[model samples]
Target: MLRKAFMRVFSAHPIETIAACTGLFMIVLGVALGTQHGWVWFWGQVSAVFGASLATLAVVWTVRMRTTETRVAANIDVLARQLETSISQIHKSVKSGRDEQLPPSVYLAQLEQCIDNLIGVSHELGEITGRPMPYDVIEMMTTRHTLQIEAHLAEGKPAPERRLVTETDSCPSCKQTVEFQIGNQPGDSAKPTCEHCGQRFHAHRSTSGSIFLRLPGASQFTRAVSVSCPVCASKIPANIDQAKQHSEARFCFSCGAKVSIDPVSHACTLISKQDKLAGRFDAAGVFHCEKCGEPASVLTSNINGTFGICRKDDALVVLPAAAAQGSPKTDAA
Candidate 1:
């Protein structure tokens, strides 16, 4: 126990113990010499002790500076390596067109994080050493990385409005390549009839990846049917259920014309707004549009409640049966 305690005290305060021992030895020597030679010998010994203490402190400070410098350099190296690895991974992803692994937004976010780390390391290195930091290489790498990302985004973009895609498909019957119109979105397919053969397919595709299939018989009709506007020749899309319910009206997208279609013939016709409004009820009674002044044969009971009337320009007018009483007659345009 005494040996262990002596070892701990010696390790903890070796410098203080050595100084105390030297001072004690000098005091004993001074006493011996004072009986003979004197005060000059004692003063010289004190000066030597003070110089040794200052030299020991200088050595400790130098060692601390060296240890700190080495650690900072190591940290800078680690950060640089990490940043490089991140950049390489991003470059590989862009090259392989494997951006699905991470979305562009996520990729950009990671790149930003790496750039921040690189910037922090550069700043720390600058603070540690007064030398000019080599951040130009980092700046160049960042610029190049940014350009690559932008290029990938540009490549993913759709064709310009002016540069229309000529959708080429061969007709099943005629086997002739037909180029479709310009405005359809990507993957928009249709069982378009061949202009030469008048052949049509049972299935079709819309811009939003919706499939429209022609029904086999009377009970079920095609969900979405594309028709042309009689007045403007522009395409109009209609849903069969909406046409039957009369709750929703289909109108021409190009011209402000009311459009109706024969489900069997798929014949599109332009009708007056008054005719469209009047078509919303059963034929048991006559009804009139107070705003348009056109009369329609309808069931009074069906229309006695408030009816939502869809007009030519997509405006909805809610009307009650009492508004149908007497109105100025107007002709269809």
Candidate 2:
């Protein structure tokens, strides 16, 4: 216990402890000799020892303060150099990104790297200054940049095939199925008024390309539907809410055929085979040359169906299918 107490006090104030102990030892020696040397001599010795102890303490404290200041200044210099290096690296990265025509995704990734470097510097600064780093601005900047990149990428790509289809959603107020027409564009939106309750609701495309209807302070919902591909007979999953205000094109995954869905009739029609490039049938049931847009005459009929063939300038066009019946027939050359 004694040793622990002594160590605690000595570790906290070693110079003061040593000085005080030396003075106490001298006083004790003086007390022992006071009986022979008298009280006046003992008091004189005590004053001298006390003054010396105070002088020693002052000198030690000044030296310690100077040493601590020097160490802190050295640390600060090292930290300053490190910070300069980090900033230089950040500038180089920014310049490189500006000089190169990088894709939006690549540019955003580099920007994120720069942000991470800045965050590291912020952490270092916080450690030195004992203050919390303000990260809200950084977060906001990151989010803004990410959104801009996303918008740029979206605009660069071709718009998805748009088709008008009827969508059904339950009205929050009336609890009845509300039917409306919408486009299949992924981000397209509409405002629909409920017929049953006259309540207005906001409708928009979800990330999965389905139409979602939502009322104020209410959850969103969608109507699911499935259709079979006319060419391959494979089931195609779709959301009715994704139908557009006009006819749009869709590709069948199973047979690679471009299929068109009638918005009003909900019928799937074969447009063209994606791989074959054999041309498409028009709305009027007339087969046309894929390259020249000229109506192709039926070259022959078979058990499969009627095949149309046409010549565009020097190129001969062969269509995969012809009108069901009454198509113009041509003699084989």
Candidate 3:
């Protein structure tokens, strides 16, 4: 009864702050009268009246605060629905297997949008949970969204087939067959080694197009340097030093190696470091392709991690793997 009457007092017709206060005072007066006229009863009335007034004020504050919270929640719910709709559309478009059909910039833009939505909601959910939200929830949602799109392009994002040119009995580069020397004693017998001295270098041949360096700083559209192809009259720039990590932007487009990229035009300038581009340079680094007896060094971009290989022709190209082989390793996250 107190609650109903208090609410009525609050919402009463012709409501005024002072009139409401007066009604509240009268309600307390009635409670005091009901305890009878004895001195003990009169003191009890006083205590009850004071306690009830304080309780009423607290209830009023709580109700106002809750009502404001309800309005805010309703607005958030509206925005959440919009986020859900956008996510659904993105899911369909990305999974369509026609990324080529979409604009090139679309992928990056859409990915950014998807991430933004996920992040916004994650923060909001964190607020509701009143604790640090687990990263798994956000990760799972994003992973599913990203993977679903890639699934349509490459069969469930399989491990790209990597074909490495391994050391064989016959060197693919020199075609010199390695032979085992006959030794009477096993302990002193050196295992079968490369017959060709210095030419025994392991030349890896994988069409999988290994990308060891990618320049995120490089502008869109392919960049080129002035160099000629050794095999063909391809006027492409080649730089032998492009194999170093610091020289990816200077990588050549024709030979798949790092070159000196022109800062203004984004063109690569050929630099001759061919003395080290053979037989043993990349024995520590990744690239080991030794075409024309010249093994070039390699460079990888830090941001995109696109690998570049140096060429004897003093040119670099986007290191590509064998055409029939699988995709190259990427430093892209």
Candidate 4:
């Protein structure tokens, strides 16, 4: 126990330990001198050793403080350099995006990467300075850039006027009707918090330029039908509105081919290959039309069976489904 205590004390106070050892050696030498001469000489040596130890402690503490300050200054310099580099990268990305007219998604991704680097630097600076990093400014700038990207993606078109949409169904949390505003373009989305129970709602615009609202846990009540893809013959699970008996187009995960299925009989028909189309699916599985390159919308009825609809300029083009054993037809609407 004594050895461990001595080790702890020596590790915590190395200058004190050295001074103690020196004082003990001087005391032993004084005892030997006292045996030869007098005890008064030993007491004088003890007082001198005590004063010298205090002087050593003060000198050591000053040196330690200076070393700590130097290290801290060096760390701050490195962090500042890192922050400057991140900002430079952001500027370069923005300049290239403007010059090349990059796609909105690509530009937004690059900007986000730069912002992440800056945020990392900010966190390190906060740790070194012992202050909280203010993220409000960063968040505001990100939101502004995102909105600008969204506008650019809209192809210079003014966004549709905002309008309140009341949910037809009640909220799952409180069983109260929720109303939210949606002003997103054909490819954007909005998330609004529920007033009654604080639940969040997602509002998305489809490729066909239709807006739809989704409530939490709403998918559990949705019905799905299994059908085989006409292109790859792979099984695809497609969602359908049971009450309205409406079916929408779905992409086959196996072959990446868009197929339309009948809600009643689950008859699948090929619409077009994903590579030949210019659209993307949002998080809610709703397609967003980037360009009307081909017939991409699905229409199914008792008489028409399954067909694809495409909008080109001012006219509507109808494309008959490519069934396994039937001739395809094309019509203009």
TM-score of each: 0.29, 0.30, 0.31, 0.33
Ranking by lDDT: 2, 4, 1, 3
Cα error, candidate 2, residue 24 (Å)? 18
lDDT of 4 by residue, 1-333 (tens): 999998986776677677666766665665555554355776656655664665566457747866888898987776677667657766765764465433333334445545545655665576677787765332533353454445344334344454545434445457677766654434355677878889886555443445455554422112334688888888875444322233467766555577877756777888777543334323322223445544334322112122233444222223222221142211110
* Candidate 4 global Cα RMSD: 18.5
Q: Best candidate, lDDT-wise?
A: 2
Which candidate, 1 or 2, would have the higher lDDT against the true structure? 2
Please provide, for model 3 over 78-173, each residue's C-alpha lDDT reduced to its tens digit, 9 standing for 90 to 100: 557746855774674465215332221223334444544555555455556566545432243345334434432332233333232323344433
Per residue, candidate 2 scores C-alpha lDDT tens digits across 211-329 of 54556542221122347888889975433322234344455544556677655456788877654335444543345667778865433222334334343422223433233333332
Residue 332: error of model 2 in Å? 51
TM-score winner: 4
Global Cα lDDT for candidate 3: 0.40
RMSD list, candidates in order: 29.9, 23.7, 21.6, 18.5
Off by over 4 Å in 4: 1-43, 59-63, 137-333
Give stretches of model 2 more than 4 Å off.
1-40, 101-110, 136-333
Better of 1 and 4 by TM-score: 4
Cα lDDT of all candidates, in order?
0.44, 0.53, 0.40, 0.51
Q: List ranges where model 3 is wrong by over 4 Å.
A: 1-41, 95-100, 136-333
In candidate 4, list every pair of residues with a backbone clash: none
